[model samples]
Target chain A: MTVGILFDMTKCIGCGACADACKEQNKLPGPVEEVTTAYTWTTVEAREGQYVRHLCMHCLVPTCASVCPVAALHKTPEGPVVYDADKCMGCRYCMMACPFDVPKYQWDRAIPIIGKCIMCTSRVKQGEATACATACPAEATVFGSRADMLKEAKERIRKEPDKYIDHVYGLKEAGGTGVLMISGVPFEKMGLKAKLTDEPPAMRTWQVLSNIPDFVAVWGVFLYGVHWITARRDTVAHHEAARKGPDTIDTTHTGRPS
Target chain B: MNSTATLPAGRFRLGFWTTVFALLTIPFLAITFLRFSKGLGAVTNLSDKFPWGLWIGFDLLCGVGLAAGAFTLTAVVHLFNLKRFEPIVRPTILTGFLGYIFVILALMFDLGQPWRIWHTIIYWNPHSVMFEVGWCVMLYTTVLSLEFAPVVLERFGFHAPVRMIHRLITPLVIAGVILSTLHQSSLGTLYLIVPSKLHPLWYSQLLPLFFYISAIGAGIGMVILESYMSKRAFGRHLEMDLLEPLARAMVVALGIYGLMRIQVIVRNGSYADVLNLTYEGKMFLLEFVLGVLLPVGLLAFRKLRTSPTWLVVGAFSAVLGFVVNRLNVSVTGMERASGIRYVPSVMEVIVSVTLIGIGMAAFALAVRYLKIFPEEKPAEEPEPEGS
Candidate 1:
């Protein structure tokens, strides 16, 4: 039921039509180019004479969404990870957390906010494809259910293993991104980020954070016990010295041995 | 050498350092004005490639790390009931309190909206590490104020409230230690999301542990260094008996941190990172050698531990190393993956310096007005004639 985009880099023609259509649809106010920016949410970068498109991977377990303190960014059931500006505190943690480095901030605004591809959730709800996919001339960008996208991608790779890289980018990266890609060249060579763990980054942080309650409980009990014993020893030694009074032996030392 | 002679003179000195603070702060304030009026791009050299810069690395990361002394010292004196270390509890709390104030100011300046910081309080995402950090920092700042309220009360001759606060200190110390441990370690958790971005040398599952241990050492080191400066500034006698034991504790903390760091590098097979001697590797060497190894080596010597001068040197080196360690994690370790070399603009450094000035100025003012360093009560001493 998860909607997604399947971008075939081999079919991309390096044209800037998708970029222009996105700007027109989103009403982004800035200079028009396929450059990476808060206004320009997508980039059709070139590598060795082939065109490769880059945008938000939109993970099933989104680290940007998980790390956001206000839950300003969240994954919708329809499959587009979206941002709510009304809830955003502008911490820029989402910028730091994105594995693909996709979230861009409007640094020049009076009040800044994160800007990234939303997978055109409004259009998809109305059964329309994303602007970039609709405007794509070469059939490079296809929109469908994630299951259909994965099935079609694997079939294409199987039919012509020599024609494609035989691996689908974003299939399991950061725990399987919603946007899938099949490229002729290796993903790393195409300036696509590589080596991300299949496990989501949020899971790593939680491994440490989940243990915190246990740590606090154990440490708290141990310290309290020590404080109690020290106070008791101090009380008893004070009375012992008082009974012996001023002219007693030189037991100058007292209280828990420093 | 009484307080009357030395205190005000040291504070109001119209000297080179004061002129420097003024010189830097004027431009610093001007840049700040530009930042708010225009935008972040107006004053900062930051780009999408480098979302964080000097503010996050130096002001936020290093500033918070340096302020660890307040909780560590408080726990030692109150929770552990080591009465010998009691003299340092107040000043360390003041330093920590002022340090957090500066961090908040810096964070506001760095935030794009700056006003919506309160959104974190109302909107709860308990899953976020930043959420934990946010709550802990706010709560701990309050704890610090309560811990230090007695000093302010004592200064104002409010004996009733002072007595009430004294009775409540046990719970206050417990809360402070817990909250500080939470945030101090969670600061490290902020970077755990960027495993692919952060270099392997700095990235580990044990980052939170490393952060907590190093911070404890940093806390002890700060107490040693600040206490030494306060001695000269206020003409107070050096409490060597207390400070020596404090230094010994720092040695153990630093030793543990250093061992763990070495183990992480060795187990990850990052030895080639050091052997290759690239820019990142060299920076790692500097942080590991000077920041961890050198300080631990110096303090481990029994002779060096006892000497005030040597202990100061060792602690200062450790503190310097700690600053580098944080910068290495937040900035240097991030350089390779970022594909852009980030050198902060002049205005960035100036704003940072201005914040430091404000922190120091506020600390000095507090020291002047409050009974932060109280003279010992004469009742405890046996009569001189009897002795």
Candidate 2:
């Protein structure tokens, strides 16, 4: 039930077919010469020595899902982080929270919706392959259950040790992502960061804010008590002073007792 | 009863809404049109990278921060029971109420879907700091209104409810102060989520503490500014007898804020960022100098505290400094991850201009109609008995 994609960059021929098919299937505008909304969900970024396809990794514990205040972006039980435009208030809290910056805004629109890949969940439910997996002329991309794809990725690296790099990207990055990658070049050289910690970015802030309610409640009671005691003392002192005439009364012993 | 108490019984003042204020509203109206019709993108230079802009930076952040004057004064006068400062209580509360009204107005503009603002209640995300800030702000606004209601009722010649409300004002004022304190600190806590994104100098775990302390300093600065302006505009005497003691408190407040800020800097080992030759570094120095150092130095002097001109100058500087700090957090400090820089277009500036224009005009109207200033005492009256 847990399906995923394995994009092996060592075998890709840098063809624009997969990207083209994605645009058509998703009803996006046709591809431009450079990557943009009209064409670019699957972008081919030029690394130092290789070209890497960039798209949402569809993380297991999606940072995008955790940060969306209105729950516009979410993780489905099947595993892809999907965007629900109807619920989107477009506050863009997810943008700041995402380390990879996958979700893009349609800035040109009068009323824009956040845009991100949904892992072709519709095709998966229909028991068909994704457009990119189906259209790959070189068999560069493979689609199957995450466990199966992961096993195949490790087996390929093991059989031909020198042909592929000794690393599997996205297997455990950001608390393990759904999409796995086997690249000939190092991930850092492929313009993909391998430095992100397993901890979701929003937790640090939540931890601090969670402590406030308790503090505020305690502080509120303390301040109210102080206000009461002070006011009552003033009232008593005022009554005491009123009993004495102004001519002989001393002002020093006024509010509160001497 | 004086002629003033009977309500000015003549034609409305013709020049009441100044030409400048009217002119400012034109852009505001137009910007509002584009905002609703074309959406937030049309009216603001806001990107996903910068979700908040000038309205939040100026009106809600600095405005509410400055409005801290009300609670600070109320706490000093009512809690500490400093009888000499009683004349300022009503005016301070009025300013706080108006400032809060402006805050709600600003929020309305900044919201991407203003219609769904009510969803904060229906879909309450208890873990979200924003949920806390939203509820706190709404509750505090209510507290301020109730704390200020007696003043309005007193003017309308309603004595019974006024007396009943008077009994609750003391507790209401305390509740209002506590709520304000929570939200004001939480405002800074909102930014703590983006530690890596915020500039090192501005980003710290101590953000909440710094925000709370700076608000108090800004609030005192606002009081000084208000007292000075009233003296010039209404020909009222500057209340230095009260302000002299207040200036001493401000000195201590600013001193604590300054030390705490430096302590944070040192603890983060980002103290070197202050001396770093980067744009963020320069801005940090400017925030430190104008917001904390210069104001503290001026207020510390007894002679400066007594002089209306120096006090006003110090206060204005502090206010400007607080505004800069907010802008730095919201706009200037966010490093460009998208490789795009944000510059507010004319429409964005127009909407911001309108909000400020309306706030000023509304403030002027309140001053004219609400009996905001305390009535001047008789020339040769005997000294009133003290409590």
- Judging by TM-score against the true structure, name the best candidate: 1
Q: Candidate 1: TM-score?
A: 0.95
User: Where does candidate 1 chain B have its weakest 10-residue lDDT segment?
Assistant: B378-387
Please give the TM-score that candidate 2 achieves against the real structure.
0.87
After superposition, candidate 2 runs with Cα above 4 Å error: A1-12, A29-42, A59-61, A121-176, A179-197, A239-258, B1-17, B336-338, B378-387
**lDDT (C-alpha, whole model) for all candidates:** 0.84, 0.73
Cα lDDT tens digits, model 1, A1-258, are 788899998889988677888788888888665567899878788886688887888899999998899889999998899999998877788888889898888888777888998888899888889999999999898888889999989988999889899899889999999899998998899998999999999899888778889988987777678677766777776666668775643332236322
Candidate 2, residue B199: Cα displacement in angstroms equals 1.5
lDDT of 2 at B13: 50
Encode model 2's per-residue lDDT on B1-387: one tens digit a residue: 122322353555545446666776777787787777777777788765555667777777887888888888877776666656777877777778778888888777766666666666666555556667778778888987887787678778888988887787677777787878887887787777665567667878788878888888888888877777655444466677777777777778878988987887788877776676577778878887888888889988989877766777788888778878877776667754345666677876666666666766665566667767667654522212100
User: Model 1: per-residue lDDT, tens digit, B47-133?
Assistant: 788888889888887777788999898887777776767778888999999888888999888887879888889988877898888
Clashing pairs in 2: none
- TM-scores, one per candidate: 0.95, 0.87
Off by over 4 Å in 1: A247-258, B4-11, B376-387
